[model samples]
Target: MGIPALSLSGLYSLKYGDCVRLPSGAEIGYEANVNFRNSYFIPDAVLRTVAGDIIAKEVFPIHLTEFAAFGWAWPEHGNDFMFIWTQETGVVKEVENPDLYNRLSQDLGETYFGASKDMNVNTLWIFNQLKEQGRFNSDHCNTKLLTW
Candidate 1:
């Protein structure tokens, strides 16, 4: 059996910066304020091995209404995975190991333009689907099959 892992979640506003807490009882206090010029605000989560070696880092858009994008980095394997969820079309697309040049322009364009309708509230529903389907399992990451 795989070891239990920590999952962090929280809400942040201008008044209260990142108030997210990890399952281990550690908290991520405020760090920086959001910039309106930027198109996305990515909140991050880290997963470490039992020995304390960082295994993976996950980043996702803080606002569900914005373009649905999630990224995962595995330093051990030198690999990265990116996923974009389109609200309008209800499509989830993957851009494996995207590079700096195409990461935003091309991939994000495909995600945003491919959709036919907006999926504001449904973004959370999709996240629940991933969680329910065991996408957060350590085995999935260990086998390089990160589903979420």
Candidate 2:
């Protein structure tokens, strides 16, 4: 997607800011603010679709596979849970292991990893499905998920 251009007047009307969460869960304030000289227009519906697609992908792991089940059930039930696993850990994308991916996809069904509508809210559903199948350990990292 391209950067959106907003008209000077409309740009001035935009409510640009951020809601920061403190250690005590308190909002701080918004960041830098500025006014643009030109205005670029985009339809609200188009914006919503684009935003929804991004939310879905971000919520759903493109690469999902099945592995050994742990003592617990397949899908773990919790408020923030996304997927369940046994002992597997690492990248969950197809590029990690094509053969394993194919096998898991066959066993679980293609619908397991399709486009989602409300990923932020539905991630729990995906996690539940994974747990039900006795497979969790699945993970996703954009670029190897390097951490300090």
Q: Tell me the tens digit of each residue's lDDT in model 1 across 1-148.
A: 1221111112223322323222222122222232222244332233333233332343332112234333333333545544433333222224543354244434443322112235332222333433444423232121111112
What are the models' TM-scores?
A: 0.20, 0.21
* C-alpha lDDT of all candidate models, in order: 0.30, 0.25
* Overall local distance difference test of candidate 2: 0.25
Candidate 2 pairs with clashing backbones: 5-40, 6-39, 6-40, 7-39, 74-131, 75-131, 75-132, 84-136, 85-136, 85-137
Which candidate tops lDDT? 1
TM-score for candidate 2: 0.21
**Residue 131 Cα positional deviation in candidate 1, in Å, after optimal superposition:** 17
Error of 2 at 18 (Å): 24
- Ten-residue region with minimum lDDT total, candidate 1: 1-10
Clashes of 2: 10
Tell me the deviation in Å of residue 37 in model 2: 28
